[model samples]
Each structure stands twice: as C-alpha cells, then as structure tokens.
Target: MELSVVVVNYNVRYFLEQCLVSVFAAIKGIEGEVWVVDNASTDGSVEMVKLKFPQVKLISNQTNLGFSKANNQAIKLAKGRYTLLLNPDTVVQEDTFRECINFMDTHPDAGGLTVKMIDGKGRYLPESKRGFPSPWASFCKIFGLTSLFPKSKLFAHYYLGHLDKNATHEIEIMPGAFMFLRSEVLKQVGLLDEQFFMYGEDIDLSYRILQHGYKNYYYPKCQIIHYKGESTKKGSLNYVIVFYKAMILFAQKHFSKQKQNHFVTMIKLAVAIRATASIIKRLIIKVWLPVTDFALMFLGAYLLIPWWEQFRHGVTNIYPRDILYALIGFYLLTWIMSLWLYGAYDKPQNLKSGAKGILYGTIAILVVYSILPQNFRFSRAIILILSAWSSLSITLNRILASTFIEGLLKWNARKKSVCFIGTASELKGSEELLIQAGFHRNNITHLLPEEVLDEHQRAKKEIIADAIKYKNISEIIFGTEGIPMTSIIHAMMYLSEFDIDFKIALHGGDSIVGSSSVEAQGELYTLEVIPLAKPVARRQKRIFDILSSALIIVLFPILWIFLVKPLMVFKSALQVFKGEKTWIGYNHPNISKQNSVLKPSVYLYSKWGKGLTSTVGLDFYYAQHFSITLEVSELIRNIFKTQD
Candidate 1:
C-alpha cells in the first residue's frame, strides 16, 4: 500500500461516521486503506462500520485503550510507506490525501506533514504547529506571558508566530489532527509513547521525529475541518488533571534534570502564591475595606464640621489659601469613603454595571451626608458634583475590570468538556435547551448504553463504567420521562459511587426547586396567570362592544352617520315614490317589574297609481324585544368561549 490512515475512535460515533465518509469520498483514487481502531465504543460504532463499510479493516477493543496504544495497534497491521494518524472528528477535503502524499514523496527528508485545519466555522486553529515545549517555553505559556507579549519575538517563539500560515515550513510540533508520517521514520523512532495516554503522546512522537534528524512540515496545500475536542470536551476537573499529568510525564521524558526540577518547583510556588492571593483578596473585601471606610467617614464628619463653621461667615475671615485647602480636604475624604463603600476595589466578578453601581453609591453618600452633624455646612453644589464624578469613575472602573476578568475566565473555561447521558430523543431536547441557554455544543458529549444480555442492568453498568472511564462528566441529567423508578434509582446509585452530582426531570406536580426544567412537547406548565374575577359573560360582551364600536367609529364615522342613515331614508322615500307608504314606529312593553323592552316596527301600505294599482292592505307582526341586544351578547359570549 502507498498509504494507510489510522483512526482511533472512542464514543464519537456520529462524528467518526462523517469523518470516514469524507475520507472515503476524498481518497477514492488514492492508494490507501482506512483502518479504524475502536476503543470499545458502546454507541454502536463498531456495528456501524460492520454494517455500512465492511471493506474497511476494523480493530475493536474489549476496553478503551488510550489513543497512542490504539493507533499503534492499527499501525502494526498497516502495510504502507506512510501512515496518517487522523482524528475521527475531522473531515478531509478531496485533495488532502493526494496533496499530503505528493508532498512527502517529493520531500524525502520530511518525516511528517500536517495540513492546515479549519474548525467547523472556518476559523484557523492555531495549534497546527508549535515549538518544542522547553522550560522557558512552558513557563511563558503557563504564565500567559506569550499572549501578554504576543509581538515580542523572544516571548512568541514558542507559538512560532513568525511562521506564515500560507507557506509550508519545518516546525517542532504538529497537532495530531492529520499527522502524515513516513513509516521508515516511525521504524527508527519507535511507536508513540503510550505512557502519556491521550494528550502528550502526539507531542512526544513529533519531537522524537525531529530528534531523529527528520523535518516536520506544516503543509497548507490541503485542508481538513476539525470539529475539535470531540473526545475530551467534558468533566473539567478530570480533563485538567489528566492533561496536566500527561504534560508532567512528557516533561520527565524530555526535559533536562535542572529544567525539570525548576518546572516542578515553579508549579508548586505558583499554587502557593495563588492560594495566598485568594485569602488576601477575601480579607480586604470582607473586613479591611469596610472598617477603613467607617473610620474615614467619622474623621470626615469630625474635621468637616469645624472647618465649615470657621468659614461660615465669609471667605475674608480666613485666607483664600486656607479656605481652598479646607474645601479640597473635605472633598478628598468624601471621595475616599464613597469609593470604599461602593466596593470600588472588589473583585471584578462581583462588580455590577454602571447603573447599579451608581444607584448603590448614591444611596450610601446620601445616608452618610445626612447623618453627619448639622454644624457641618457642606456645600450642596460641591457634594452633587463629587457624587456624579464618583459614580462615573466607579462604574467605568468596574466595567473595564469586568471585561478583562470575564475574558480570562472564558479562556480558562474553554478547555473543559462535559458529558451528557440520556436516550437520543432526550439528549436532543436537552442539547437544544442547553444551546439556547448559551452552552457550547462542542463541550457536550453523549454517553450511550450498549446492547447486552440483560439490558436494564447492563445499561446501568455501562453508563457507570463510561462515566468512570471518561472521568469528565461534570453533570449527569436524567432527561427521559416515564423511566422506571428502579432504573432511576439504579442510575443515581451508580453515579453516586463516583461522587458525581446529577439532576433528574421534574414530573407532574413536582417542583424543580434548585433544578431547571425545560418545556417539553405537549406539556403545559403555567408561567403566568391573568385573573378573570368578574363573570366571563358580562365582561366579554362589554369589552367586545366597546372595542368594536370604537374601531368602527374611528374608521368610518362619516359613513355610519351620513351614508347608512341616508340609505335607510332613501328606502323609505322609494316606498312613497312607488305609491306605497311606510312608517317607522317604536313600542315599549313591560317584561318585569324593573325591566321594560322597546321594539321598533315598520308598516307598509299598498298604493294605487296610474302605472301601478294596489288595494289598501296591511300586515302587522310584533317584533321580539331584546332580540338585537341578545344576538350581540351571544356573539360576544361565544367569542370569549372560543378564546378559552
């Protein structure tokens, strides 16, 4: 074979499927065989390969072997000149394989080549190439000095910022997204070091290739879209611990003795410093600032009253300089107290927005100024100006600080991953809700159960084992409804063994309390209520009649008064014109002791004329009282009923 692609998959079945599909579609004419080494995926990953692409070779493990060992297992069976370690979450363009193969074929000195990888949203991933992590590089990266001094050559050397993305060049390390390696280079350097498990293995392998006098090229001629963090995007604490532990192992393997010791010492010192800083911050926020503000306010009142009294008569009593000094001292004291009381120096995370900060600060100043002795004749104008300045200053300070703090928090939090557990439908619902609520989809991993002889018991065990194995499930939610109580209990009990925290769906009549509940299909939960205190019948008719009449009057006032009335009059006149007479009359009849009904009656008279002759005849009928009003009332009532 000319090339062999090794993909190590673990519980990313859907992404893996898409990846394989893209690879096969892209490499149709390329000379290669695709090998998938599945690390015991319980999400039908192995079955998918068997059913859909039987021609491809698959190695299914009984348990999840780490990434390096799994890939090595496939590498042992590969018979190719070059071996490409590809992530299952990545999609290759049609030219990717051909381009990489051609590059390596032309450049005999190159040991490995990596293509430019864009994420799903078409943003370039910066981790494509990096300098080897030496003691200085590690320190710069850990302390965020590289980002702080991004344009400085000495500081950004680790990130290789000098290298342009549009050009191919030799680099110390390439990400494992699409690492195309020469089989001969691997034979000389040995397979990937499995001791580091997931993360550091790729770095170790790339460094080893460079150490053996082979160049690693960052080839941008071809491209692949990396979904990024598909496998390890959950269980923040576990991910951190595992990743750092792997880094330590890598450090032990590669770093010089002195550098290694210094790195370890630096890490320990950093932790201690962080803890002390946190304690100091708490003390200042909780105790020192509040006590200091109280003291300053008292001093301001004591000194301000005497000074103000001395200058109460006129500025001539004291020198101009003395009066100015007193005014400045009083203003400084007020400013200090206001700043402290408003939590100006508090942690950025605790800071409120401009409006809230101003509101609180204003209230504090008002109380402080009011309770001071009446002898202190403070100028109202000075107080107003200082208060406005203080509000603006404090609010702007908080806004700037919060922006910086939030950015840092988000950057640090991005490395974390979370695993979700539930059926497909339940997980989809949960995912939609979480996405709407601002949780990134890349951080979510679904833990699915495998088929077994005893499905219920096996499912419970599988879920528990997956949680333990992945060790990154920050929160487990039972999203499925109508699950047996026993199953729920089993799941909860299983999760509790790992000291995992979880939430369950809230059912009928059950209050969620601290938990959140999302709206489900066909499930109605009242969010608000509008009380219909009065009888629905009367309220509906009155509202309808008022609204309808108002709209009609506004839209057609002239038509109602002139055109409609004149039409009726013309009809009456036309009867006279035709030699027939008509009369419009009203009659009142008492229906009950308190109620009377009015009815309108029309009578027609037959006429005799030159062209038309008619005998005198009359038809009389009593119109039903309350008929129009009753019809209108019924229509309004039905409208309200339909709305309900």
Candidate 2:
C-alpha cells in the first residue's frame, strides 16, 4: 500500500465517525489502508468502527495503554510507505492526503511531515509546527512569553511562529494529531516512546526523527480541523500534571549533560505553576462567592446591633467590633454551612438555587439566635435586619456573578449567549431542554444547518461572522443529526476569528439524567468532565461513613435507649458491614446506577452504601456536584441535620 492511516481513539465515537468519513474521501485514488486502534473506549467507538468501517484494521486494548503505545501497536503492522497518525477528533480536507503524499514524494530527505491544522473554531493552530522545547523555549512558553510575542523569534520559537502558515518549512515538531511519517523512517528512528503516557511522546518522536538524519516538514497546502480536547481536557489537573511530567521525561532523555538540570528545573516550575492555577480556579469558582455571603452576613450582624440600640434603648454606646464578634462569626458560619448543605452555590446556577440557599441560611440563623443566652443573643430587631441584608446581598451577588461574570469578574460566572446550531428538525425540543438546563432563555438563539453549509467556505465565513457580530453568540451547540461534526468543525473554522464556545449535545434516547445533566442524548461539551470510577473514592466514603456513624452512636446516649433498640441500628450496621447499606447515601440504594449530573440516574450516589436516615435529598445533590470539598460539606450537614 502507498499510504496507511492510523487512528488512536478513546471514547469519542461521533467525532471518530466524521473523521473516518473524511479519511475515506481523502484517500480516494491512492493504494491506501486505514487502521483504527481503540483504547478500550466505552463510548461505542469500537462497535462503530466494526460496523461502519470494517475494511480498516481495528485493535482493541482492554485498558488505556497511553497514546504512544496505542499508536505503536498499529505502526508496527502498517504496510504502507507512509503512515499517518490522525486524531479521531479531526476532519481532513479532501486534498489533505494527496497533497501530503506528493510533497513527501518530491522531498527525498523528508522523514516525516504535518499539514496545517485548525481548531474547531477554524483558526490556524500554532502547534501545526513547533521548535524543540529547549530550556529557553520551554521557559518562554511556560511563562506565557510565547503568546505575548507570537511573531518575535526570541519568544515565539515554541510554536515556530517565525514561519508563515502559507509556506512549507523544515520544522522540528509535528503534532501527533496529524503525524505523516515515512515507513522507512520508523525503521531508522524507532517508534514513539511508551514512557510518555500522553503528552510529550510526540516531541520525543519528533526529536528522534531529526537525530536519525531525517528532516520533518510543515506543509500548509492542506489542512485538517482538530476538535481539540475531545479525548482529554487541557483544563483538567490530571492533564496538566501528566503533560508537565512528560516534559520532564523529554528533558531527561534529550537535554545535554550540562543543561539537563536547567530543563528539569524548568519542567518542575511549569508543573507547579499549572497546578497552582488549576487549584486557584477551583477555589474561586466553588468557595469565593459563598465566602462573600459570610462576610456580608457578619457585617449585617454588626451594623444591625447599633441600629436596634438607637431605636429600642435610645443608647448609642456603639458596641466594640470585638463584642460578641466571635459568636456572630460562629452563627454566620452555621448559616453558610446550611447554604452548602441545601445545594446552594452549584455551578450553572438556576434562579431557584440562589433563593433556596439564602432561605436555608436565614432559617439557620433564626434557629441559632432562638437558642442563644442573653449575653450571646442579639435583639430580634437586629436578627430581622441582618436576615434581610444577608439575603438580598447574597442573592444579588449570585445572580450578577453568574450571569454577568465577564463584566464584574467578582465571582465564577458561565452566563453565555447560546446559538443552537442544527437542522430545523433536530432542533425541535433543544430550546426547551437548554432553558431547563439554566441557559438564559432570552439569550438563546438559532443558527440553522443550512446557514452554515448552504454556500462555499467564503460565504459561510461571511454569514457566521455577521451572526456573531450582530447576535453576540458566545456559545455554539451542535445537535446530533441536526449538525455533522464536519459541519460543526466548518462553522468553528469559519467563525474562528470570533470568540465562541463549541459543544456537542448528546441527545441520546437514554432516559437517564440529573437536574442539568444527560438524559435523552449525551452532550460531549467542550471541557466536559466525566467522573472516573475509582474504587478508592468509594472506599473513602465507606471509611467516613463507618467512622462518623460510630461516633454518633457513642455521643448521642439517648439514641441507645429509645432509638437504637427500636430502629434496629445494629441491624442496619450489620447490613452496612455486609455491604447492603451505607452510613450515608441516596434515599434508595437498590435503584439503577447513575454517574452523571446530566441525568437523574444513580450516577454518583450509587457508589456508596445507602443510609438509615437520609438528609433530605443530599445524596442526590452530591450526586450532581461531586468533589472532595463538596463531600466534606455534605458530611458536616449530615452531622447537624440528623433525624431518627
């Protein structure tokens, strides 16, 4: 065979289908063969390939063996003079293969090549060509100097930004997304280093191609659209750590003896920086806005006292900031805890979540105030004023922070003007679903499939540009059957100049869904996180349940006489020991297993043992928003809000 195409896929079946369709079209006249090596994807990618493209060779691994190893499996058996490692989340232009082959054929010294690439939004991806990550180049990139001076030779070498996109050039790196290499070159340079689980293996392979006397070229004659982050999200902490660790592996292998320490140090610093940024982002989104509520509550509590004294006792001896300040802090902390337990501060906030969170907080304050000694108590007049101020401030902050996030940057906001793009038929109930999912109903608009593909590329670009300018569409949703990946990619490329977000709506016929999660179809939205089923996470919950339940049994002595005997506490504990029940879990244990916020299915809650006394729908709430921090918050609530 003249050409062999190798695709490594992990759970992106829809994108893989579109990619194969484009690949089949690209390799038309040539003696070409395709190999798809699936990395044990549960997204039905293996089944799709077997059913739809059986002509292609398929290798199915039982577990994720990393990107390098998966590609090596297919590369070892490839029979073509040239092998192309293509990402599943990409659409190749019709001329991509032919142009690459012709260029390689003409350049007798070309060992490997990569064509120009664009992201889903259609802008040229700088990773299409790159210089080796020497210490200096890595530093510039890690510190973001490369982005600051894209066209400058000194700072922009990471992307080889010195080169023009319109011209072919001898570059140092070709992305794994579109690595077209000579079969003979593999015999000389060896395969991708399996030590790299995902990130730096491409850089390692590219450097080896150069070390072995083969030249790598960046050809811009044809392009493919890379639907970036479909396989792995760049925003994830795991991705960040793994990526930087890959850099360290590269530095150890390739850096000079004298400069190895420098490169290693740079890699470590980069990892630290990325990890810190990820943590800060999570803290701001999850805790920062809620903290403001606490601060305002304290302020309201302090100010209301003087206002009450002036009216009731006609004594304006203003209390010192220290007077009952500690108690006020404790009381407000309980209220905020109540907010967290009541499912307040959930992302993608709906109108009611904010109101309910504040309501819970107010009730908590009232409960605490009613039980306080005279020395600790503030007057009822002060309590009412504090409640009003705290409720209004917290509610307004939640609304403005979520909806007008960009304008204020005061809180974590995801308010977006969404453009639903699909065929008119496919879009029938999409609008209603999106509204229920908490997108602004008024901000939601439609962009038909015809408008994106009715004309040529130039015309499509014009139409999309005009729409983004006039309608201010911040997010673009692709409907299944309503929009093909190719069309979605095309729209992204055409609207590349515009700042917008792209998402694939998984509108499957599955009936499972959470409050704002997957139900009928599953949307693989951009950077959408899928919870990994780790047995350790479940074990932690078991440990916590066992410890907390034992403590409660011992501490609450009255429970031993009246409640423990009648309610069969020992029997429940036996069931828990036998794995039939959990100390804390869903309202029902034997229900269907669910794992996503998108559907109401057992998703996250099903992992734990069920509890004897459930706290409202907290199990289901945690099921929607799973995190160590949120888990701790739920545990705290279970301690205070117990029912026999």
Measured by TM-score, the strongest candidate is: 2
Model 2 bad stretches (over 4 Å): 1-5, 9-63, 78-81, 88-108, 233-241, 265-287, 290-292, 316-327, 342-354, 364-381, 395-422, 429-436, 439-459, 470-472, 477-490, 503-644
Expressed as tens digits, the lDDT of each residue in 264-362 for candidate 2 is 877888888888998888777667777788777777866777777787888865545575577667667766765654445544334555556567667
**lDDT of candidate model 2 versus the reference:** 0.68
| lDDT by residue (tens digit), candidate 1, 448-516 | 433211444333556455754676765555433334323433454344455443443322211111111
Count of backbone clashes for each model?
6, 22
lDDT for each candidate structure: 0.57, 0.68
lDDT of candidate 1?
0.57
- TM per candidate comes to 0.45, 0.70
Off by over 4 Å in 1: 267-644
Cand. 1 TM to true fold? 0.45
